[model samples]
Target chain A: MRTFSAVYCEWFKLDEKRYLDEVKRSANSHSPFIYPTMELLNENLDNFINHQEETVISFSQLTQYLVMKLAHENELKVLLDGQGADELLVGYDYMTGYYLNQQLRSLNLKSFFEELLTVIKRKNVEGLQLLSYHFSPNFLRKKILYRNKKYLSNRLNNIISQDNFYLSPMYKSKSLTTALIVNVDYKLEKLLR
Target chain B: MTFGIETRVPFLDFRLVVYLLSLPDEYKYKKGTTKRILRDALNEYLPELVKQRKDKIGFASPDFKLLKELDEKHWS
Candidate 1:
């Protein structure tokens, strides 16, 4: 129910002036706007490397740390975020491209699935089960041969399943319903928690 | 976890998430528009200008500009 606004501004860049202007324009939309000054730059830099020692600090992580620091200073204990909506809603342009391409390029399913499996193999060590499911000759043949409405429906299900292949090592279940549940329970819940 | 401040994501509500996931991909994204369903759902409640805005600037900060300023002031 409570809404808070904050803006981090730099007095230098012309492009960032637009960002500052936008923040100022939207200031009235939320209550208690908190402007974290440039003076905290050194403190934020110090905090970034204080814990991990060797970990590289990304810009987003630094911004998050600054927000947390500001919240602490203001004595605000809880903050509400709008995370997990993007992943669930396919809000990212890359994901949209992936889904649209997979849907339109049915003829290239074999090579596409193979490339995906290869990437998964290289990036992830626990993707063996998912790789096996996609790499099976029998499954690939059936998926390629079947061209009915039922097959299309199954393909959609497979797409969702493939999207969630990295949720858990035990995520071998092919059911879309179960996959959705697992994604919500394991991934989204873990993030929000 | 470092800040000791609790962050809650209300958008990840179980029912809402289930409904979103169950909806077709077209409903979620359409013609390069992201969060289409969310925009459509909140169309009536939000201001017309707010609803019409397209860009999604997510928690952006001016850290780059700050760093540039520091570099010019101290290093240069």
Candidate 2:
């Protein structure tokens, strides 16, 4: 049984050249379940697109489909998916900004600073760059939407550009909890289907 | 859920979900660590490396070149 580790190496191996060589060696040795993974994707692209009755957002979804198909071929009757963990547990990196915003909003400066420092150290980013987003959730949300405008259809852009456009209930909220609620209400529903 | 296989999501259990939601936000994410409570709760049971892992790959492929090729092929 080929596990996840057998398929994919860790994100950051210490030696880059050695890691690439090892990956090439393993790819040659394993040959995988149905050719190489990506080639399988290319071969099955038409079937995959037909299989989906709705829109596809990310390549992760495609990979997940491939995994489920592989599991089925392996005769696995049931699979456990960790889907709701991120929404329930505030697991996304962007949620850190919401958490910091909550801390600052609630007059929890000590906690805010503590979390801010940890984020800075872990991500190696300047703290000041994060402040505008952390302090103003509305601004951050608008900025995000504006940045994503190119990806949106003209109809979507026009709709969102309206001053009275109704955002979700959580729009005004800076709390991570509220953000998670919005994710559950909107994002998780799609994934559930 | 596809390919005649059933998918179960334990984390979406109503009781557990509600319990997590009711807790303070900081408990869920603190000190740059998301899922802090889960990591702590499973500390005794989970391997040290898993509990300490900061990256959340979530079964996504790491091969960007392959993905780029696929994207180009699909769009083109």
Candidate 3:
């Protein structure tokens, strides 16, 4: 499937901007999913979007990966993964655990090991990296930072269904947008042909 | 693709962008993430049965309950 993927590389390029925008905006913003893998996906998106107009394969390592993925599966779908600094070190899972527990922030996230994940990646807040020391469980400031009641609420409501008491007119506008994106991308794409 | 690849998405239809983008950015983020809007939307589309469903079966638990009667010398 190397040739198949290669044949579609240009198509991937054409759609890359829309896909990249969605992936980055979704992956970068606070959510319940792992970021590093999302990040790796984002980086591959760079080969499509950065517009440097250079070779897609810049080094021997990438060439070897493509070749191996092609020969083994005859389909190049062997799951090229970043493996782990997260699972091994527990980063993405931390943020997810926090996000889940945020529904009831009184519930703690320190005691589960179902999924291996990394820390909540830091993003620039004005200019500061807001999450640099966020994972230290016992650090007072870090604890206060990562466990903020405000952020916890946001992350919880982001993933879980609402209790319906709070579904106001304002909520409908936002819901319409998400509903619109999902239907357009996943449903309508199938029906168009 | 042979027809010069002119593509158009209906939901992302220009008329839609004109209406939505002109609205407030406040609709995007709140407290921390986009959950409020998303949940409200899902509640509308998914049936109440689906919206209320929450049961998952898993085997990832520690096996002590199953292993309590197993012989330690079995491997030998």
Candidate 4:
């Protein structure tokens, strides 16, 4: 059920992304609705679309926000997006980091871990997932997720299982799969549901 | 709604580049690649579960296959 919702959500999300790219527009498209709330929603959408027009964020306002975050609310919800930070951050898949560590064995593992940490701290959950993969290179030998099986729950695991990881039943085993199902109580049903 | 803007990218610093390049290849690109330093830096926070990531996977949504069955049973 969760996977189904995520899929259904993702398809529309992807379709929206494509439709936006084709139109070079932001969310909500150009639809006008009769409800006042819908009209306000449209206007807010327009604000975001307009903001995309000015991609650069200058330092003057940045310092203000930084100072504000520093001062208030234990900085719990401080969203840390910055301008053109991608030049420094790779923001690539975690497997890339794993491949890099494997391929570039000569580098100082300590310092490399530093750079990866900075990125993980800055991004969202997907970033966290990749960070997980980077830590355990040998774990991918089996289709089964490791102990605890939290993020790699059956739904997320099954989505990833669609790939040809060449994972064996050994190593982690279906025990991991079964544990995830018992804990989460969700699995992808066949089309016959 | 009120909005504010700010920008500074220490990453783009010319001095940072020169400083990075000044490091030995053993430190800069240990196996002869860029970003070789990140692995060591992030090793601690790196999740153990992900260390098993040997393959690249794309996300496909939950069993919409059930949708086909639902159609067959109800909407068909």
The best candidate by lDDT is 2
- Per-residue alpha-carbon lDDT of model 3 for B1-76, expressed as tens digits? 2112222343344564445434432343222333233335666554444333222111121122212312242312
Compute the lDDT of residue A10 as modeled in candidate 4. Answer: 36
Q: Please, what are the lDDT tens digits per residue for candidate 4 over residues A3-56? A: 000112333332122322322222223322111122232334444546435421
Docking quality category of candidate 4 according to DockQ thresholds: incorrect
- For all candidates, the clash counts are 0, 0, 10, 30
Question: Candidate 1: which stretches are off by over 4 Å?
Answer: A10-38, A51-57, A106-190, B1-3, B61-76
Which digits, one per residue and each the tens of the lDDT, describe model 2 over residues A1-193? 2322224333423212333344445544322332235566787777778888665544556666776777777777876777788878876665676677777888999987998888877772322333454445665646643343345467766665663234344444566677677767666565575
Off by over 4 Å in 4: A1-43, A54-79, A82-193, B5-10, B13-15, B21-34, B49-76
Residue-wise lDDT of candidate 3 within A71-178, one digit each (tens)?
Answer: 344422332222221211112211233222332233334522211122222221311212222233444433333332232347564433242223222212223234
The per-model DockQ list reads: 0.34, 0.49, 0.02, 0.04
For residue A170, model 3's alpha carbon misses the true position, in angstroms, by 27
**Model 2 ranges with Cα > 4 A deviation:** A1-36, A124-131, A134-141, A149-168, B57-64, B71-76
Per-model i-RMS: 9.0, 5.0, 18.6, 17.4
Worst 10 residues of 1 chain A by lDDT: A143-152
TM-score of each: 0.56, 0.73, 0.21, 0.26
Error of 4 at A49 (Å): 3.3
Give lDDT tens digits, candidate 4, residues B1-76. 1233222345435565445434443442322133445545655643433322222223222223333444465555
Q: Is the docking of candidate 2 incorrect, acceptable, medium or high quality?
A: acceptable
DockQ of 3: 0.02
Judged by DockQ, which candidate is best? 2
